[model samples]
Target: MTIVLTFMPFAVGIMDNDLRQLLAQVARGDRTAFAKLYDVVSGRLFGIIGRILPRAELAEDALQETFMRIWQRASSYDETIASPMAWMATIARNQAIDLKRRSAERLAALASELDETLADESPDPESLAGQAGDLRRLGECMQGLPNERQQLVLLAYRQGFTREELAERFKRPVTTIKTLLRRSLIALKECLDGAR
Candidate 1:
């Protein structure tokens, strides 16, 4: 299906108060509140995502990612900085961009796109096998962490977010961010080392 994406002005003030209340409840780990928030805001967020990714499938993927991030990072939302929808819109936009970049990079890097194998086309089978195995094992290790910690790890390592950025996003002190990251890395190392 074709998806036509366009940027349009969003109506404000109507749900701002309720959204703030819902976000507060979500921060306290109320799943019902989260569900309400989703029901209230998903359409607008989807529109925001669609504006970044024209393809229906890709926009849908971005919308899912945005909500997943919102669910994971609810505790970090601060009403002082921006309105609830604004904060969520930023997340949706960032996720859409990330998804778009990944899609492009994957397409460009696909082995199937290559006409002929060259010396630099890819690593040898042994190296590729080992790398894939290591990645799988690492993913397994990451799954052992709590969801919040897992998101923090991904933001820090995969997205290259600075400690300051993490502290701001997570609403934690820099020292706390450092401590948590260190602890998480140690746990991952332990898991990886002990798995074999």
Candidate 2:
């Protein structure tokens, strides 16, 4: 089967009535409407994923997952509560966050396995001393952040809390948590660079 996708001009202050209609049609299992909906909002959704995910390939993967979720969940979407774009953006954000959380969990698992394997391996005294100094430097840098930011950074990075989980624990929006993390990372980078 051949599919043709159509693109519609979208701009700020432009109502997404057409997009909303397309989504409604897609919910009825209309493949042509799905293709048109993809063409209409895929760029914006991809940009959202790209901003959230560090790697291009991961962002692309997240975008694909976002669309898959959109296709699966179209019938559950409520037009009264959110615009089509907002609903789509939420799906994209969620997919990106999920991908990041899964990646972190995999890395954490690998690190834990490595640590267990290396527990009996003793390092030279010089290497131990160097590691001690680095840990001290890191502690000093972390202390420079505000208490809330310090806690957020530790919970998010060191403890492997996802942004959504941090939002729930801190009673803040996920976007706020993301912003705090970005600022905290920038501050740490500057502090570490100056200490070097």
Per-residue lDDT of model 1, residues 11-75, tens digit only: 56767888888888888889999899989888988988888897888899898888888888988
Q: Which candidate leads the pack in TM-score?
A: 2
- lDDT of candidates 1 onward, in order: 0.83, 0.85
lDDT of 2 at 14: 54
The pairs that clash in candidate 2 are none
lDDT for 179 (candidate 2):
65
Clashes of 2: 0
Candidate 2's TM-score: 0.55
Query: Model 1: residues >4 Å from true position, as ranges?
Result: 1-11, 111-113, 117-196
